[model samples]
Target: MDLLEAIRKRRSVREYTGEPVDDAVLRELIEAAVQAPSAINQQPWTFVVIKDADRLAQISRKAKSHLLKASLSEPAHSFREMLNDPDFDIFYHAPALVVIAAADPTDWAVEDCALAAENLMLAAYAMDLGTCWIGFAQNWLATPEGKAELGIPATYAPIAPIVVGHPRRPPPPVPRKNPDILWIDAQTHCA
Candidate 1:
Protein backbone atom coordinates (compact mmCIF):
# COMPACT_ATOMS: atom_id res chain seq x y z
CA MET A 1 0.00 0.00 0.00
CA ASP A 2 1.08 3.60 -0.66
CA LEU A 3 2.51 5.58 2.25
CA LEU A 4 0.03 8.43 1.95
CA GLU A 5 -2.87 6.03 1.66
CA ALA A 6 -1.74 4.14 4.74
CA ILE A 7 -1.34 7.40 6.65
CA ARG A 8 -4.77 8.56 5.59
CA LYS A 9 -6.44 5.25 6.36
CA ARG A 10 -4.80 4.75 9.73
CA ARG A 11 -7.25 5.09 12.61
CA SER A 12 -7.32 4.50 16.33
CA VAL A 13 -9.22 1.26 16.36
CA ARG A 14 -11.05 0.31 19.55
CA GLU A 15 -12.67 -2.88 18.32
CA TYR A 16 -10.61 -5.81 17.08
CA THR A 17 -11.11 -9.41 16.09
CA GLY A 18 -9.46 -12.37 17.78
CA GLU A 19 -7.48 -13.23 14.67
CA PRO A 20 -3.90 -14.15 15.37
CA VAL A 21 -1.18 -11.99 13.83
CA ASP A 22 1.62 -13.95 12.18
CA ASP A 23 5.04 -13.61 13.72
CA ALA A 24 6.67 -12.58 10.44
CA VAL A 25 4.11 -9.85 9.82
CA LEU A 26 4.36 -8.52 13.36
CA ARG A 27 8.17 -8.47 13.14
CA GLU A 28 8.01 -6.51 9.91
CA LEU A 29 5.78 -3.94 11.58
CA ILE A 30 8.26 -3.49 14.43
CA GLU A 31 11.11 -3.27 11.95
CA ALA A 32 9.33 -0.48 10.13
CA ALA A 33 8.74 1.31 13.41
CA VAL A 34 12.43 1.40 14.30
CA GLN A 35 13.24 2.99 10.94
CA ALA A 36 11.95 6.33 12.19
CA PRO A 37 14.62 9.01 12.72
CA SER A 38 15.77 9.65 16.26
CA ALA A 39 17.82 12.34 17.96
CA ILE A 40 21.50 11.41 17.43
CA ASN A 41 20.14 8.06 16.33
CA GLN A 42 19.75 7.05 19.96
CA GLN A 43 16.94 4.62 19.10
CA PRO A 44 16.44 4.24 22.79
CA TRP A 45 13.31 2.15 22.67
CA THR A 46 12.23 -1.36 23.52
CA PHE A 47 8.99 -3.24 23.02
CA VAL A 48 7.23 -5.93 25.04
CA VAL A 49 4.87 -8.01 22.98
CA ILE A 50 2.10 -9.26 25.28
CA LYS A 51 0.09 -12.08 23.69
CA ASP A 52 -1.20 -13.87 26.75
CA ALA A 53 -4.90 -13.30 27.42
CA ASP A 54 -4.54 -13.70 31.18
CA ARG A 55 -1.80 -11.07 31.28
CA LEU A 56 -3.77 -8.71 29.08
CA ALA A 57 -6.82 -9.00 31.30
CA GLN A 58 -4.72 -8.42 34.40
CA ILE A 59 -3.13 -5.37 32.84
CA SER A 60 -6.51 -3.92 31.99
CA ARG A 61 -7.78 -4.43 35.51
CA LYS A 62 -4.64 -3.03 37.16
CA ALA A 63 -4.48 -0.06 34.86
CA LYS A 64 -8.02 0.84 35.79
CA SER A 65 -7.21 0.33 39.43
CA HIS A 66 -4.20 2.62 39.25
CA LEU A 67 -6.14 5.27 37.34
CA LEU A 68 -8.84 5.26 40.00
CA LYS A 69 -6.28 5.70 42.76
CA ALA A 70 -4.74 8.62 40.89
CA SER A 71 -8.03 10.55 41.10
CA LEU A 72 -9.09 9.68 37.54
CA SER A 73 -12.66 9.27 38.67
CA GLU A 74 -14.16 9.27 35.20
CA PRO A 75 -11.86 6.51 33.96
CA ALA A 76 -12.67 4.55 37.07
CA HIS A 77 -16.31 4.67 36.12
CA SER A 78 -15.43 3.74 32.56
CA PHE A 79 -13.38 0.82 33.84
CA ARG A 80 -16.30 -0.43 35.84
CA GLU A 81 -18.45 -0.32 32.75
CA MET A 82 -15.72 -1.99 30.74
CA LEU A 83 -15.47 -4.84 33.20
CA ASN A 84 -19.04 -5.75 32.43
CA ASP A 85 -18.68 -5.24 28.67
CA PRO A 86 -18.05 -8.51 26.84
CA ASP A 87 -15.57 -6.80 24.54
CA PHE A 88 -13.58 -5.10 27.26
CA ASP A 89 -9.89 -6.02 27.42
CA ILE A 90 -6.87 -3.92 28.19
CA PHE A 91 -6.09 -4.11 24.50
CA TYR A 92 -9.64 -4.31 23.21
CA HIS A 93 -9.23 -7.98 22.25
CA ALA A 94 -6.27 -7.35 20.00
CA PRO A 95 -4.12 -10.44 19.56
CA ALA A 96 -0.95 -8.53 20.29
CA LEU A 97 -0.02 -5.64 22.55
CA VAL A 98 3.25 -3.86 21.81
CA VAL A 99 4.34 -1.92 24.83
CA ILE A 100 6.83 0.80 23.96
CA ALA A 101 9.37 1.62 26.62
CA ALA A 102 11.89 4.44 26.31
CA ALA A 103 15.22 4.87 28.05
CA ASP A 104 16.81 8.12 29.27
CA PRO A 105 14.27 10.67 30.48
CA THR A 106 16.35 13.73 29.46
CA ASP A 107 17.47 12.44 26.06
CA TRP A 108 14.25 13.31 24.25
CA ALA A 109 13.43 9.62 23.97
CA VAL A 110 9.71 10.27 24.17
CA GLU A 111 9.77 12.15 20.88
CA ASP A 112 11.73 9.35 19.25
CA CYS A 113 9.30 6.80 20.66
CA ALA A 114 6.34 8.79 19.31
CA LEU A 115 7.85 8.80 15.83
CA ALA A 116 8.44 5.06 16.06
CA ALA A 117 4.87 4.52 17.22
CA GLU A 118 3.51 6.43 14.23
CA ASN A 119 5.58 4.23 11.97
CA LEU A 120 4.31 1.07 13.66
CA MET A 121 0.68 2.18 13.43
CA LEU A 122 0.96 3.16 9.78
CA ALA A 123 2.84 0.01 8.90
CA ALA A 124 0.20 -2.08 10.61
CA TYR A 125 -2.49 -0.30 8.61
CA ALA A 126 -0.65 -0.96 5.37
CA MET A 127 -0.50 -4.63 6.28
CA ASP A 128 -4.25 -4.71 6.93
CA LEU A 129 -3.80 -4.68 10.70
CA GLY A 130 -5.39 -2.35 13.25
CA THR A 131 -3.72 -0.49 16.09
CA CYS A 132 -4.88 1.58 19.06
CA TRP A 133 -2.52 3.72 21.05
CA ILE A 134 -3.08 3.07 24.76
CA GLY A 135 -1.68 5.99 26.74
CA PHE A 136 -3.32 4.87 29.96
CA ALA A 137 -0.58 2.24 30.30
CA GLN A 138 2.00 4.95 30.91
CA ASN A 139 0.50 6.19 34.15
CA TRP A 140 -0.25 2.63 35.17
CA LEU A 141 3.35 1.59 34.69
CA ALA A 142 4.36 4.30 37.18
CA THR A 143 2.50 2.51 39.92
CA PRO A 144 4.22 -0.14 42.04
CA GLU A 145 2.05 -3.09 41.08
CA GLY A 146 2.00 -2.11 37.41
CA LYS A 147 5.78 -2.05 37.33
CA ALA A 148 6.00 -5.65 38.60
CA GLU A 149 3.15 -6.75 36.39
CA LEU A 150 4.54 -5.32 33.14
CA GLY A 151 8.19 -6.07 34.00
CA ILE A 152 9.26 -2.52 33.06
CA PRO A 153 12.61 -1.61 34.52
CA ALA A 154 13.41 1.59 36.41
CA THR A 155 15.62 2.81 33.55
CA TYR A 156 12.85 2.54 31.00
CA ALA A 157 9.76 4.73 30.97
CA PRO A 158 6.49 3.38 29.62
CA ILE A 159 5.44 5.43 26.61
CA ALA A 160 2.46 3.85 24.87
CA PRO A 161 0.90 0.50 24.11
CA ILE A 162 0.27 -0.14 20.42
CA VAL A 163 -2.50 -2.75 20.37
CA VAL A 164 -2.33 -4.72 17.13
CA GLY A 165 -4.98 -6.95 15.55
CA HIS A 166 -7.49 -7.21 12.75
CA PRO A 167 -10.17 -4.52 12.69
CA ARG A 168 -13.72 -5.72 13.19
CA ARG A 169 -15.04 -2.81 11.14
CA PRO A 170 -13.54 -0.19 8.88
CA PRO A 171 -13.13 3.16 10.61
CA PRO A 172 -13.82 6.44 8.85
CA PRO A 173 -10.86 8.59 8.00
CA VAL A 174 -10.33 11.50 10.35
CA PRO A 175 -10.77 15.05 9.06
CA ARG A 176 -7.66 16.89 8.01
CA LYS A 177 -6.51 20.34 9.10
CA ASN A 178 -5.88 23.38 6.87
CA PRO A 179 -2.25 23.70 5.84
CA ASP A 180 -2.42 27.49 6.11
CA ILE A 181 -3.00 27.18 9.85
CA LEU A 182 0.62 26.09 10.14
CA TRP A 183 2.97 28.97 9.33
CA ILE A 184 6.03 27.10 8.14
CA ASP A 185 7.97 30.09 6.88
CA ALA A 186 6.88 33.40 8.36
CA GLN A 187 9.37 35.83 6.78
CA THR A 188 10.59 38.41 9.31
CA HIS A 189 13.53 40.78 9.11
CA CYS A 190 15.06 42.70 12.02
CA ALA A 191 16.92 45.99 11.53
Candidate 2:
Protein backbone atom coordinates (compact mmCIF):
# COMPACT_ATOMS: atom_id res chain seq x y z
CA MET A 1 0.00 0.00 0.00
CA ASP A 2 1.09 3.53 -0.68
CA LEU A 3 2.42 5.54 2.24
CA LEU A 4 -0.28 8.20 2.06
CA GLU A 5 -2.98 5.60 1.70
CA ALA A 6 -1.72 3.71 4.73
CA ILE A 7 -1.45 6.95 6.68
CA ARG A 8 -5.04 7.81 5.87
CA LYS A 9 -6.41 4.34 6.51
CA ARG A 10 -4.49 3.34 9.62
CA ARG A 11 -6.47 3.63 12.83
CA SER A 12 -5.79 2.95 16.51
CA VAL A 13 -7.47 -0.43 16.63
CA ARG A 14 -8.67 -1.42 20.10
CA GLU A 15 -10.42 -4.75 19.49
CA TYR A 16 -8.54 -7.83 18.35
CA THR A 17 -9.25 -11.48 17.48
CA GLY A 18 -6.79 -12.92 20.03
CA GLU A 19 -4.70 -14.45 17.27
CA PRO A 20 -0.98 -14.26 17.92
CA VAL A 21 1.06 -12.38 15.35
CA ASP A 22 3.78 -14.52 13.79
CA ASP A 23 7.36 -14.01 14.89
CA ALA A 24 8.49 -13.48 11.31
CA VAL A 25 5.80 -10.88 10.77
CA LEU A 26 6.80 -9.14 13.97
CA ARG A 27 10.39 -9.12 12.76
CA GLU A 28 9.29 -7.58 9.48
CA LEU A 29 7.43 -4.88 11.39
CA ILE A 30 10.53 -4.22 13.49
CA GLU A 31 12.61 -4.03 10.35
CA ALA A 32 10.28 -1.41 9.04
CA ALA A 33 10.44 0.39 12.38
CA VAL A 34 14.23 0.55 12.40
CA GLN A 35 14.23 1.96 8.91
CA ALA A 36 12.80 5.14 10.34
CA PRO A 37 15.34 7.97 10.32
CA SER A 38 17.04 8.71 13.60
CA ALA A 39 18.92 11.83 14.63
CA ILE A 40 22.64 11.40 13.87
CA ASN A 41 21.94 7.74 13.05
CA GLN A 42 21.95 6.79 16.75
CA GLN A 43 19.32 4.11 16.03
CA PRO A 44 18.86 3.72 19.75
CA TRP A 45 15.56 1.88 19.99
CA THR A 46 15.07 -1.57 21.55
CA PHE A 47 11.97 -3.75 21.65
CA VAL A 48 10.30 -6.02 24.20
CA VAL A 49 7.63 -8.34 22.82
CA ILE A 50 5.05 -9.71 25.24
CA LYS A 51 2.92 -12.68 24.05
CA ASP A 52 2.10 -14.43 27.34
CA ALA A 53 -1.64 -14.12 27.97
CA ASP A 54 -1.55 -14.47 31.74
CA ARG A 55 1.26 -11.93 32.01
CA LEU A 56 -0.60 -9.49 29.83
CA ALA A 57 -3.60 -9.68 32.13
CA GLN A 58 -1.43 -9.34 35.18
CA ILE A 59 0.28 -6.22 33.86
CA SER A 60 -3.06 -4.85 32.72
CA ARG A 61 -4.43 -5.10 36.23
CA LYS A 62 -1.38 -3.53 37.78
CA ALA A 63 -1.23 -0.69 35.29
CA LYS A 64 -4.94 0.01 35.72
CA SER A 65 -4.59 0.13 39.48
CA HIS A 66 -1.68 2.53 39.17
CA LEU A 67 -3.61 4.76 36.81
CA LEU A 68 -6.64 4.82 39.12
CA LYS A 69 -4.58 5.76 42.12
CA ALA A 70 -2.71 8.32 40.03
CA SER A 71 -5.85 9.88 38.60
CA LEU A 72 -6.81 10.96 42.09
CA SER A 73 -4.07 13.59 42.24
CA GLU A 74 -3.59 14.20 38.53
CA PRO A 75 -5.91 15.62 35.88
CA ALA A 76 -6.94 12.28 34.36
CA HIS A 77 -10.54 12.41 35.52
CA SER A 78 -11.92 11.16 32.20
CA PHE A 79 -10.17 7.80 32.47
CA ARG A 80 -11.20 6.91 36.03
CA GLU A 81 -14.48 5.21 35.15
CA MET A 82 -13.03 3.06 32.40
CA LEU A 83 -9.97 2.25 34.50
CA ASN A 84 -12.22 1.21 37.36
CA ASP A 85 -13.88 -1.53 35.32
CA PRO A 86 -12.06 -4.84 35.63
CA ASP A 87 -13.26 -6.10 32.27
CA PHE A 88 -12.02 -3.11 30.32
CA ASP A 89 -8.58 -4.24 29.27
CA ILE A 90 -6.09 -1.55 28.40
CA PHE A 91 -4.63 -3.82 25.76
CA TYR A 92 -8.02 -4.65 24.23
CA HIS A 93 -7.08 -8.36 24.54
CA ALA A 94 -4.53 -8.25 21.75
CA PRO A 95 -2.25 -11.26 21.58
CA ALA A 96 1.00 -9.35 21.19
CA LEU A 97 2.60 -6.22 22.54
CA VAL A 98 5.83 -4.66 21.23
CA VAL A 99 7.32 -1.95 23.36
CA ILE A 100 9.72 0.60 21.90
CA ALA A 101 12.34 1.80 24.33
CA ALA A 102 15.43 3.98 24.10
CA ALA A 103 18.40 4.53 26.33
CA ASP A 104 17.87 7.14 29.01
CA PRO A 105 20.48 9.62 27.81
CA THR A 106 19.97 9.14 24.10
CA ASP A 107 19.35 12.49 22.47
CA TRP A 108 15.99 12.85 20.76
CA ALA A 109 15.04 9.42 22.06
CA VAL A 110 11.33 10.08 22.32
CA GLU A 111 11.12 11.54 18.83
CA ASP A 112 13.18 8.71 17.38
CA CYS A 113 11.03 6.04 18.99
CA ALA A 114 7.85 7.79 17.86
CA LEU A 115 9.11 7.77 14.28
CA ALA A 116 9.84 4.05 14.58
CA ALA A 117 6.41 3.47 16.07
CA GLU A 118 4.70 5.22 13.16
CA ASN A 119 6.61 3.04 10.74
CA LEU A 120 5.57 -0.09 12.64
CA MET A 121 1.95 0.93 12.82
CA LEU A 122 1.76 1.84 9.14
CA ALA A 123 3.43 -1.43 8.21
CA ALA A 124 0.93 -3.33 10.35
CA TYR A 125 -1.97 -1.58 8.63
CA ALA A 126 -0.58 -2.48 5.24
CA MET A 127 -0.17 -6.10 6.31
CA ASP A 128 -3.79 -6.44 7.51
CA LEU A 129 -2.77 -6.23 11.15
CA GLY A 130 -3.84 -3.80 13.88
CA THR A 131 -1.80 -1.64 16.25
CA CYS A 132 -2.44 0.72 19.11
CA TRP A 133 -0.03 2.71 21.30
CA ILE A 134 -1.05 2.01 24.88
CA GLY A 135 -0.35 5.28 26.67
CA PHE A 136 -1.86 3.89 29.87
CA ALA A 137 1.09 1.55 30.28
CA GLN A 138 3.85 4.13 29.95
CA ASN A 139 4.19 5.28 33.53
CA TRP A 140 4.01 1.81 35.05
CA LEU A 141 6.40 0.40 32.49
CA ALA A 142 8.96 2.96 33.63
CA THR A 143 8.82 1.67 37.17
CA PRO A 144 11.48 -0.78 38.34
CA GLU A 145 9.09 -3.69 38.82
CA GLY A 146 7.45 -3.12 35.44
CA LYS A 147 10.85 -2.90 33.82
CA ALA A 148 11.85 -6.20 35.43
CA GLU A 149 8.61 -7.85 34.30
CA LEU A 150 9.45 -7.01 30.69
CA GLY A 151 13.20 -7.41 31.17
CA ILE A 152 13.87 -3.90 29.95
CA PRO A 153 16.89 -2.27 31.50
CA ALA A 154 16.49 0.44 34.09
CA THR A 155 18.69 2.70 31.94
CA TYR A 156 16.15 2.64 29.13
CA ALA A 157 12.85 4.48 28.84
CA PRO A 158 9.84 2.69 27.41
CA ILE A 159 8.39 5.28 25.07
CA ALA A 160 5.89 3.29 23.04
CA PRO A 161 3.74 0.38 24.28
CA ILE A 162 2.09 -0.94 21.13
CA VAL A 163 -0.29 -3.90 20.89
CA VAL A 164 -0.41 -5.92 17.70
CA GLY A 165 -2.86 -8.54 16.42
CA HIS A 166 -5.56 -9.35 13.88
CA PRO A 167 -8.22 -6.71 14.08
CA ARG A 168 -11.68 -7.95 15.03
CA ARG A 169 -13.25 -5.31 12.77
CA PRO A 170 -12.05 -2.29 10.85
CA PRO A 171 -12.55 0.83 12.86
CA PRO A 172 -14.72 3.52 11.30
CA PRO A 173 -12.83 6.51 9.97
CA VAL A 174 -12.72 9.56 12.18
CA PRO A 175 -13.15 12.92 10.49
CA ARG A 176 -10.35 15.46 10.59
CA LYS A 177 -10.77 19.20 10.82
CA ASN A 178 -8.97 21.59 8.53
CA PRO A 179 -5.50 22.35 9.78
CA ASP A 180 -4.58 25.82 10.85
CA ILE A 181 -1.75 27.12 8.70
CA LEU A 182 0.42 30.19 8.62
CA TRP A 183 1.96 31.48 5.38
CA ILE A 184 5.20 33.40 5.69
CA ASP A 185 6.37 33.84 2.12
CA ALA A 186 7.87 37.18 1.07
CA GLN A 187 4.50 38.42 -0.11
CA THR A 188 2.84 37.59 3.20
CA HIS A 189 5.73 38.63 5.43
CA CYS A 190 5.32 41.67 7.64
CA ALA A 191 7.21 44.79 6.60
Leading candidate by lDDT: 2
Quick one: RMSD of model 1?
2.9
For model 2, the local distance difference test gives: 0.92
Per-residue lDDT for 1-191 in model 1, tens only? Answer: 88888877789998888888988888898999999998998898888788887888778877766665665566456665554554556678788888777866747888999999999999999888899998666788756676667787776787878899999998887898867664445585555
Writing each residue's lDDT as its tens digit, candidate 2 over 1-191 gives 89899999999999999688999999999999999999999988999999998999999999999888774555678789899999989999999999999965577999999999999999999999999999999989989988998997888889999999999999999999999999788688575
User: Alpha-carbon error at 52 in model 2, in Å?
Assistant: 0.6
In model 2, where do residues sit more than 4 Å from their true spots? 72-75
Candidate 2 lDDT for residue 63: 93
State every prediction's TM-score relative to the real structure: 0.86, 0.95
Residue runs of model 1 more than 4 Å from their true location after superposition: 73-87, 179-191
Local distance difference test values of all predictions, in order: 0.81, 0.92
TM-score of 1: 0.86
* Minimal lDDT window, size 10, model 1: 182-191
